[model samples]
Target: MATVLGSVRAFFAQSAYSIDQENPGDVVARERLLDRAMGEARFRNSSEKLRRGRVPADGLALVARDPDGYVIGTVRLWNVEAGVDASGNAVPALLLGPLAVDPEHEGKGIGSALMRAAVTEAATRGHGAVLLVGDAPYYERFGFFADKAKHLVMPGPSERDRFLALELKQGWLGGAAGVLVPSGRRFGRAGLRKAA
Candidate 1:
């Protein structure tokens, strides 16, 4: 009986949180969590230039929820052209950013979990590469390296070293060059037009 009880406790403890697709209802909460984790500086980030007025790639936005079902983490990927290749053909890639976890939930693996989920899903969806501007030490473990993105540049000013990438398919980014541009769907202004 004690063994069975211990198993149940372990299961519950491990299940204290869950990762899932971000639903419509999670937007506000996700935004709040991002604000808390990243503060106002997140808006001025160079990556925002590519992400602004754009929607995340289909089904690439994700959220982490705590035991009480509150959103504690968020990560999203946007489609971007990794510049034209040697043959001048546009090389497509995904830009990851604003990966934020609630301040209170720091050190609980929520950010890492969200990252792994996002990258795995992007690969499963057949994306060729993933890029982001982040701390080297934290992202290096996920195969994101500066050398891979050395030839590429963000739309706005960004530290060279902070830009990193992981090619989902080997050599997917090889020969890719030029400024990254937004290739994802934009938030249509139809609603705004109607409001006007």
Candidate 2:
């Protein structure tokens, strides 16, 4: 199903906008797009607990630009410990969230393009899994599921059914069980250069 959707998305992507690594100048636009898509409620979501003070994972922050050189979409993935409480194993997983598209650009496939980039990049860099709090109807098409994530928990309150996980490698979340936490390296924008 995921593959089928990916192909369908690809078919529509023939004339897709350009996706690139987000730069310093892209922050404001990214923030606006996020606000428009999720409103202030986004800052209070469970995933924000992990991303609060930490920087986005290296090579995982991206923006989609329109033909006019405008940033129309944004998505970022952060680092977190998959089993911070129960096992204290320090197992790493990328947390994807705040994936937003301009209101007028919603049906253009910009959001899914960013998702594909995020998951593919994480796997290429050897990360195990990707986690997020989003609608199953939307995210499941990207291969994220609650079945594997049922064994894990989030730091703050989150709708159990909305917490989803996708293993980049086969069985990446097989033994992962515990609370997700801000387990990634400490890095703000200034410290981003230090992350691998």
Candidate 3:
């Protein structure tokens, strides 16, 4: 019975792929694939901005690997805080960006698999909402939207249409407003404090 069930599952697996949390040593291949994928995606500027931040130390990265152990896609999340609200409350939020897939592997469901793994891991880790500057149509499929606009601002100039947010948990935004900034201990003790 177990053998039969396993065979049945494999038959309907759709694609023979696996999504997992990226290990530290996978950085080199991940970067190569990311560079290739971003180049193909025509998001050179966005890729450059992400590279300058040293995202690995600040956020979690998940990758989709083929059976041969090659990374074909990747997604990342960073710790960031909202700018400031009228009442002076600093809203804390997560920054999601740099989602890329190997050009040759696009439309193979790798990007979607990476996103699902990242979001699940983030929710389990007790994160708030995730804010990003991306396409509305593509991101909306993952439950991301502009509902948090009043409580969100990007670090740099971003088109209003592209900026979006998604609640990882219920009411994660809580109507808070502020500019997004890096939230990491290395930034200094003063910066380590969470915003109200």
* Cα distance off (Å), candidate 2, residue 106: 0.9
lDDT of 2 by residue, 12-50 (tens): 455657777788778788888888888999888788888
Q: Over the full model, what C-alpha lDDT does candidate 2 score relative to the true structure?
A: 0.80
What do the candidate models score in CA lDDT, each in turn? Answer: 0.84, 0.80, 0.64
Collision count of model 1? 0
Steric clash count of candidate 3: 5
- lDDT string, candidate 1, 83-179, tens digits: 9899999999999988999999889877887788888888878899999999999999999999999899999998899999999999988999999
TM-score (all chains, Cα) for each model: 0.89, 0.87, 0.76
Which has the better lDDT: candidate 1, or candidate 3?
A: 1
Alpha-carbon RMSD, each predicted model: 7.1, 4.8, 7.2
Could you say which candidate leads in lDDT? Answer: 1
Q: Backbone clashes in each candidate structure, one number apiece?
A: 0, 0, 5
Query: Which of the numbered candidates is closest to the native, going by highest TM-score?
Result: 1
For TM-score, candidate 1 versus 2, the one ahead is 1
* Worst-scoring 10-residue span by lDDT in model 1: 1-10
